[model samples]
Every structure is written in C-alpha cells, then in structure tokens.
Target: MIQIANRTISLATEPFVIAEMSGNHNNSLERALEIVDAAAETGAHALKIQTYTAETITIRSDRPEFRIEDEGSLWSGRTLFNLYEEACLPWDWHKAIFDRCAEHGMIGFSTPFDDTAVAHLESLNVPCYKIASFEIVDLPLIRLVARTGKPMIMSTGMADIGEIHQAVQTARSNGCGQIILLKCTSSYPAMPGDSNILTIPHLRELFETEVGISDHTMGTGVSVAAVALGATVIEKHFTLDRAAGGVDSKFSLEPDEFKRLVEDSAQAHASLGRIQYGQLANEKTSKLHRRSLYVVEDVEEGTIASSSNIRSIRPGNGLEPAYWDLIIGRKFAKDVKAGYPLSIDHFF
Candidate 1:
C-alpha cells in the first residue's frame, strides 16, 4: 500500500487512476479548471499538470540542436524552444488550478522538468511530483525533485533497465522512498503493440517499488490492460477536445474517452483478485450444468447396465462422468427410469 494525500492506494486491490492534463488546456486557465472538473466527474483519483517555463526547459536559441527535425514526428520542423514555449503552462495558473482541484476534492500534482520547476512546485506544497520520461536520464534533476521528500512518480519511456535502476537509486538516496515507475512509450501517439504491458510487473520486481503506466496510446485499451497487469497507477494525457489544437491534443484523450479509461481501469483492477483456481461463489450455481452420468432409459431390475442405458448428460446431480466405464458393465440393482441420476445405490 502507498499513501498519497493520506489516501491508501492499494495496488493489490485496485489501480490509482490519474488524468494527465498535460498542455491539453491550450493555455486557458478556464479550460484547465474545467478539465479538473471533468476528471473528477469520471471518478479519477488524481489530476496531473506539467510545471515548466520554456526558458527553464529549453534555450531560446534557434540552433539545429534545439530543433525537432524528425520528419515523421508530430511536431516535426519545430524547434524545441518554440515547442516548449507553446506547450508550457504559465506559473500563475497553478494556484487557481490547485484551488479548483481542492474545491472538488481531487489530488492535484505536477511533473517538473528542471530544478527550478521542482522548487516552484514545492512552494505550492504539492502532494507529490512526477518526472517525465524524457527526464529519466537527468540524474541531477531526479535528485533535486527527490530531495523534496514527497512521493515521486517517474515515467520509464525510452529508458533501459540500467537507467531505470540508477534513477530509482538516485531518488531513494535523496530521501524519496515512496516512488512509482510508470512504463511508458515516448512516442507522440504510441501503438498498442509497442506497449509491453508485462513490463508493469517486471518493473515492480526489478525495483521493488510500485509500478504503473504513462499511456500515450490512441485509446483506452493499453491503459485498461495495464491495470490488469498490476499497475498501481495510470496516467494519460487528457483534453477537453482534441480538435482544439494544443501541442499534445492530437495524442491526448477527449473528456468522454478519458471517462471511459477511468471507469475501465478501475474495473480491470477490481477484477484482478487473489489467485483462485477452484469453483468460485458464482460458479457454484452453474455447476449443475456440468456433465454427469445419468440413466438414459427405463430398465428392469437386475438388468445389466450398458452403453444404451446410461449416458453422460447435464444437470449434474449424479455420478461423475469419470465413472462411465466403471458403471457400464454393472448390473442394475433396481428399476431405473429415464432421466434418473446415476448413483452407486442403483448399481449392483
């Protein structure tokens, strides 16, 4: 069990669902508050925001190194500085958004990209901090965020096993013991095939910490599947409308889709009870439908039971089907009617 905001999050029982309002607000404070309300309505346990100014996240230089030049990328041809400029949330909006979350009783947290961003969030007394996948390799930044002594959630996208190990070590060394690693694919719009959901449990074993998923997949399939695989937390970018054209809007989920993700992730987690093999409570009633040995026709007393007289059928109030061969050549002790349940008492 992990405690966040005084609430016990039981990974063994159910997942902690989070709605990532990452640059999905389109720079509107009003929309950010509305997103919080929408997330709360969907029964989400927490709402997340990204904290960083463009100047802090990237340099304003238009150099080739600062530009995203991948042709297949969503934000291709745009410089990192320009991209961050448009995507960055103004620092002033944090208080109103946090206030709105408080009014609605939702946990508001943020992902900090740099040391300065961490300080800003610390001043706000945020319950926890999230480390984006791109920052997983930033050990110094991880140490800075971890020094705050709050619970930390890190996304493991594009990170190898060694890197993840180091990041977890850095946080623990810096006094952040409560940490969760989110299995993520760093692509803009991730594909289901690329999301190795089995990693959720593997990460838990590798680090001995809580594991989750930072889903960027187009739909809720991957997110819901992650819950079934022992994901303690789930974070997905959310927007009021994808058509509104925010930096992450194309890959983010709309309000209705996000609601479904929240509801389905909880359902998936609830369905994963302790390992059970035998007939369950609900299965007991359906046991009668199982096949069992039954008398197929009327027979006179002392008659030899044969294949024609007994058969395996439904309504399982008879000898087990495994006894069919044992009873086939036996003598009938009494007259047996058709549809009668076969039992030892009826055999000689």
Candidate 2:
C-alpha cells in the first residue's frame, strides 16, 4: 500500500481516481481552477496538470522532425513546438491551482517534463510526483524525481518491459520506494479494444509495486473493468465540457462521465472482496429458496417413496436434492401430505 498526502492507495481501498486537467484549461487559469472544482465534485481523489513550456519541451521550429507527421494523431500536421506552447500549463499558476485543489480536499500534482520543472514542483512541496509515459525513458528526470524521496506514479504507455524495468530500477535505486505503474495506451482517444488492462495485475506481479490504468477510452467501462482486474489507481483526462473544446477535449470526459467513473470504479473495487465460494451472509435467507427434496404428492405410511410423490423443489427446509436417488425406494414414515418437505426423519 502507498500513502500520498494522507490517502492510502491499495487494492484494499477504493481505486485512487485522478482527473487529468491536461491542456483542457486552454491557457486560462480561472478555467483550470474551475476544472479542479468540477473534478472534486465528481469525487476525484486528485487533479493532475502537465508542467512545461514550449521552449522547455520542444524547439521553436516547423522543420519536418518538429512537426507531428502521424496522420492518426490528434495533433497531426501541427508543429510540436506550437502544440506544446498551447498545451503546457503555466508554471506561475501551479500554486494557485494546487491551493484550489486543497480547498476541495483533493491532491494536486504535475507531470514535470524536465529537471527544472521538477525543481519548481519540489519548491511547492508536492506530496508525490507523476512520470508521464513519454518521460519514462528519461532516466535523468526519473532519477531526479526519485531522489525527492516521495511516491512516484509512472505511466507505462507504449513502453516495453525492458524500458519499464530501467525506469523502475532508476527510481528504486535512487530512493523512491513507493511506486505505481499506470497501464496506459498513449493514443489520444484510445479505443477499449486497445486497452489490454489485464496487464495491470501482471505489472504488479512483475514490478512488485501498485498498478493502475491511465485510460484514454471513451467511457467509464474500461476504468471500472480495470478496477476489477486489481487496478489501485485510475487516471482519465477531464474537461468541464467537451463541447467547449480544448487540446485534449476530444478524449477527455465531461464532469458527469467522470462522476460515473468514480462511482462505478469504487463499486467495482468493493465487489472484488476475496476468493470466496460458500454461501455468504446475505445469501443465508436466499439459500432457503434453493431446491431441496419435497413431497409433491401425498403418501401414506409404509408406502414406498417414488419419483411420482417426491421431487426436488424450492424452500430448502428438506433433505438435500442429492439424497433423491438414495431415498427413491425408501418407505414414508408417516402419512405425508402434498407440499411436505422431505427429510430423512420422514422416511423409514
């Protein structure tokens, strides 16, 4: 179990829900704080923002390498520099945004893209750090964040096991003992078919750390399914209104959808009790309705019991149905009436 700012995250508790406010703020600090308010109202445990500027993240060039060439990408044909300029959350707004998160009883943190960004967050004294999927390969940044001696949540999108091993090793070797791996697909507006969340448990087993899902799918279904598969955390991009439209709005969930995700994920986690197979406490009364041997027809004393008079029926206050074959030729000990429950004491 990992504790972050007084909250315990483990399979034993409800899945830690995070509302990613990534460029959904659209450069407006007021809107960003509003997103925080809305996320808290949706029962989100935390709100995450990305920390970096266009210059820090990319070069100001429209060259071929600087432009996103993938036709399937949401930012296709856009220069990486221009895209980051728009999506990067301003550094000056961190304190205000985090303060608002505190007002709503939610933890606030950011995905620092560079060592400078990490220092900025460290100054704010963030309780934990988040390593974005793209940054998992940045050993230096991982080393810096790990040395902070706080819990680290890393997204494993498009990363192979070897890459994950290096990131985990760097963090652990540097002093970050509390770690959580978020199984992510990395695709903007990723499809549920692509979200192989079964990897969540496998990740936990392989890394010996908490596991979760950073879902990009369209609904709460995949997130809830992840919870059942033992996801200790769930992160989804959040926007106040998809209709308003922002950089990440196409894949981001609206407030209502996020609320349902929280409710359903919690319920799914609660339902994953233990490996149990016997009748439960709630089933005690219902068990009485189970099929049992009963007298379907009248039978006089000394009469041989037969299938015509005895049968398996409901209301389990009788001999078990398993006894039917053995008692088939047994004699009735009394003048049993129709609808009588069959028991060993009722037969000779």
Q: What is the C-alpha lDDT of each candidate?
A: 0.88, 0.94
The TM-score between candidate 2 and the true structure equals 0.96
For each of the candidates, give the backbone clash count. Answer: 0, 0
* Highest TM-score against the true fold, candidate: 2
| Structure candidate 2, residue pairs in collision | none
| Residue 326 shift from truth in candidate 1, angstroms | 0.9
The segments of candidate 1 whose C-alpha lies over 4 angstroms from its true place after superposition are none
Spell out the clash pairs found in candidate 1. Answer: none
Residue 100 of model 1 has an lDDT of 86
Error of 2 at 200 (Å): 1.6
Model 1 over residues 1-348: C-alpha lDDT tens digits? 678895566576567878888878887888889999998888778899999988888788878998898887899999998888888889999989888888888899899988778888888999998999999999999999888898999999999999999999999999998999999999989889999999999998889998899998898999898887888898988888888889898988887888888888878877887788988888988978999988998998999988888889898889999988889888988998999999999977
Task: Candidate 2: give its CA RMSD in angstroms.
Answer: 1.4
**Candidate 2 lDDT by residue in tens digits, 36-58:** 99999999999999889999988
